[model samples]
Target: MEQVVNMGFISIIPSLLAIALAFATRNTVVSLGFACILGTFLAGQGIMGFPTLIKTSLGTTSFAWVMLLNTFIAILVAFFQKTGAIQGFSQYIQNKNLSRRAVQLLAWLLGMFVYFSDSFSPLFVGTTMRSISDKARVSREKLSYIADSGAAPVSVLVPITGWAAYLSGLAVGIGAIVTQEDAMKLFIKAVPFNFYALITVIFVGLISGGIIKDFGPMKKAEDRAIKEGKVLRDGADPLIGKELTEMEAYPGIQQRVFLNFILPVIMIMTIAIGTYIKLKSAKTMEAFLFVMIFMGISMFIQGIPFKEIMHTMTDGVKGAVPAIMILALAYSINSLSKQMGTANYIISISEGFLSPQLLPAIIFLIASVMAFATGTSWGTFAICMPIALPLAFSFTGGEATTLVVACFAAVAGGGVFGDHCSPLSDTTILASTGSAADHIDHVKTQLPYALICGGMALAAYLIIGFTSI
Candidate 1:
């Protein structure tokens, strides 16, 4: 075990520096890297600690799995684009000639359907629907909002997903839930109470279906798109470059758009779920790997040159490299924080305020703040779960499952809530890239909606906290 530093309040500096730098510079990699270095120094590791930092950051089995899963998904997305599968599907939708409202609704629906991975969902749905949504006069901001909201929120609610696997593992690790089965059961039970996720998902439909009128920046974006025919505001810097935003189907090839796109996705879901059921665990990474292999084979069979295919896959991997770097840095910071006892320090500071009637609300709010600052829901889960779960067990005297469930729900929901709004979040960035929206524009437009849902979720948690007690 790594030695834990007894740094008390000083331990928070690394995280605070990271958060401040991220907000100030809008560069996650730089902020996280600086923070990691500072944290290692503070932990009494000498300058040579850089080697230890790298090893600790990427050496773990869990981290490797996450990296592979994300990288493979990126490759798969590249394959989809290269095969003209995404474009073909977009054309099919265009041929249907659905109304603007219907196109928006379809984009929203596709987001929910692609609930396997949060990062993959937005990249797929946002990129696939960008042209269609643009034609409908939907602002890139709005498209990104729909994509971002749909990604994490839906992933958290669904059981057969990487989010569920990670959450379930955390729950079991807490030892409050003895078995993975029971931990997953608790996760499922908590799903209904994941108000932020549930509300965010429903809110997307409300906005898309025109049941809820736009109230803030989103309204202005929609208006600009409709009246001025500006999909992006004048001089806005979009996250995606022209090469990707304007990528065309490779010329002179038979494009079986559906076959190219749908088959691999279907295979991924089918095989992932089947393998999980057989092995009594989630095979998310394995499933993605299989899908990538299948996609490569299918493309070769379809007469796409091996060289061009390799080039496209490389481009796709390149596209995902930014996100992967963010993930690595996020993980490194989390590790450093752990070594410095940041979570424990925070828990200690807050422990005096804990009460059964207020635990859920407090946990929710804290987790939300942590995730918002860090821009990593998974990291928030890693930090908060160990702290929150034990507190719930002790506070409830180990008997009130309802309270435990509520607290669990709060942590999970809060992470998603913060992730939805955080500009530094991978999913948020992917949404902007996928929709060809300016990163800050996407953040600005989505904040109001996320806050609204977060408010509702906060109210619900308070009610559950007080009433259940």
Candidate 2:
């Protein structure tokens, strides 16, 4: 059994500090790092706790895998940009002569299609559509919001994606789910109750279709783009960086944008789904690896020198260093949360207050706060599922399966809600980077919509909780 720290209310300090600092500073890495250091110190390891923190963080296999996956994604995006594939894709979209609303809808549709991995979906869709959206007078902020809305939300809704695989494993590990097959069934049943994700996706479609008018900062961004003919606000610093912004396609090759762009994307989708079916698990990293290899080979065949390809790859990795640092710190804080017994403390305190009619709504709210602070939906799942599943089992007397499913949905939906709104989230960062929007701008413009969906989800959970009871 895992040891629980007896720090009482102090256990929540790290997460609270992290969230407060992130909002105040708009620097996720610094905020998470400081919180991690403070948490380590409070764990009674003294000043030397910093070294132990780094070692523990680096020692985690998931951290390394996430690092590699993010780096590979950056490299693939760089390759696409360098080889003119992304430009070609943009040109193809431009040739369609679609109106602004149609163009935004197209980007939304593209995001939906790339649902196998949340990380890949935003990067692929945002990069491919950024120029097109700009041409159609769509704000970079709106583009980013569209990209992000389709990412984690879509992945969690789909059962074949990496999110589902990880979530199913967590369910099984908690012992509430008896088998992988049963876990998947439970996940599928809960999908309809994932109100935040469902509503977010639908809301994106409504916004793109002009049915839902923009409000808050998003409205200002859209007005700036359309009225002033500026895709970005004046003085906005886009997250694409100078290096990637200035990268040019290789010389002396006819840019067959359609063939170059579509082929690799198709291959990625095929490998992701094919491998999942064959292996009974999603091979997200392996899919990305193979896609990178295929992209390199294709570039080489197109007369781009191997050295140039390698340079682009290196540049891509370098560009992703900032995001990687943030992710590393986020992971470190999650580890600290585990050691500090943050989730346990929260659960223990809430146990006395939980009732069947309020359990789902309460769980959703707590999971949302935890994920928002940590900037990791998976980490929230890891923390919440163990407590939630067993409590759900007890609350329902192991007979109210639908109520249990509703609670599961609340947790999953809440995680996505928090992740969608957090500037510290990896997918949120990728959406901004891929769309060439300012990171804070992305966070600011997207938050209102996320909050709206989150509120609706919370209310839905309450209704479901009451109905089930």
Candidate 3:
């Protein structure tokens, strides 16, 4: 066991400061940076600890993967813009005169189909649907909400996903979860209990299908888009730079639907899904690299000059710079979170009032707070599972009962709720970038709906807890 650092109440200051600053300034990078500095100083590393923190935090293989992924996806988004694929596709959809409801539902379905990778889903769906959604007068806020809804929430609920395997792997050796097979059974059983993910997906479907009328800030955004035909509100700073979004198609180049957009996306889906099935890990970044190459070559053959292709690629990289910087600092803050024992601090505060009837509810809330603070659901699982599962066992007399699975579901759903709301989360950032929505605007609009689902999930957990007792 790693020795626990006892900073007591002070350990939570960094996360609170980072989140508060992010909301207040609407500038994620600066907020994360300042919070990181504060966290380093408090960790007894003094002023110099900041650099060491960055060096270690951004140095990981995972961080490198995310940075590269963002760059590659940005390049593809730029290529799509430059080739006029999105615009051309929107034109076709316009000719079809698809209703706003149809367009929103289409975006939701597209997001659902791209379930192989959470990172790939939002970017592809956002880039594909942004023009179409705008044409239908769908708010950028609403589009982003659909894109964000489909990523982690959808990914975590599917039983065959990497999410399921990783979560199952986490339960090993706890009570009756003695092996991978044992853990898998328990995880599968807990899927129906993942209320937040289930309800979130359902909510998207209802709203997109126009079954549920828009409410809260989203209703305001939708009203503006409908009444004023402004997909984005006035003065909104979209996460994606206009360099990509506003990049005009090269002159005199024919925009072939198959070559410019559809084929390259097909290639991405094939490569990503094919590899996940055969190799057990999705080669998502490699898929992006290959598609980008295919797209560049295809565009070169389509009469777009070699120089223009190169220029668009450069612009693509530039457009992703802001998101990349935010991600880098987000990683740093998460690292700082670990070193300062933020999750541990939250857990310590909540672990005292335990009973069988309340275990599921409290565990869910703790996992929610932990993931919300750290902005990573997988990280939340890694920390919460070992502690939470064992504690549940103590109450259940070492049995993997319905109460145990309920606890499992609580952790999974709770992590997702927090992940959805946090600005520092990668999926939320990716959603904003994908839909070309303002970063803070996406959060402001999506939080009310996420909280609704979360509240319902909490009520369900409490009901289950009381009945199981």
Best candidate, TM-score? 3
Q: What is the lDDT of residue 332 in candidate 3?
A: 88
Can you write out model 1's per-residue Cα lDDT over 1-469, one digit (the tens) per residue?
9564557977778878876786667566788889888878988898977569878778998678766766776677678777788778878888998987898888899899878778678877887898888888999999999988889999999887778888888988564588888889988999989999999999999999999999798999999999999999997867654545555666776778668888787887777668766765657778788778888888888888899888877776676666667677767776776677766666666768888888998899888877775567998898788778888888677753788899999999999998788765778878887787877778878998899999999999889988876
| Model 3 lDDT per residue over 180-285, tens place | 8999899889989999999999999999999999999999999999999999899888888778888888887787877888888889888877887788777889
Which residue runs of candidate 1 sit more than 4 Å off their true CA positions? 1-10, 17-55, 58-66, 172-177, 234-237, 240-243, 395-397
Instruction: Give one clash count per candidate, in the order shown.
Output: 0, 0, 0
lDDT scores in order: 0.81, 0.84, 0.89
lDDT of 1 at 450: 93
TM-score of 2: 0.93
Question: Candidate 2 lDDT, tens digit per residue, 1-469?
Answer: 9566747677778878877886677666677888888988888879988778888887888888878887888888788789887788788778889999999899899899999888888887788888899889999999999999989999999988778878878888444588888788889999999999999999999999999999999999999999999998887767665556667888867777656677877888898888888886667788789989988898888888999989999888887777677777767777777777776676677767788889899999888887776678888898887778888888767753878898888889988998888776888988987888887789989999999999999999999988987
Candidate 1: C-alpha lDDT: 0.81
Error of 2 at 22 (Å): 3.0
Q: Which residue runs of candidate 3 sit more than 4 Å off their true CA positions? A: none
Displacement of residue 35 (Cα, Å) in model 3 is 1.9
lDDT of 3 at 18: 91
* Alpha-carbon shift of residue 213 in model 2 (angstroms): 0.7
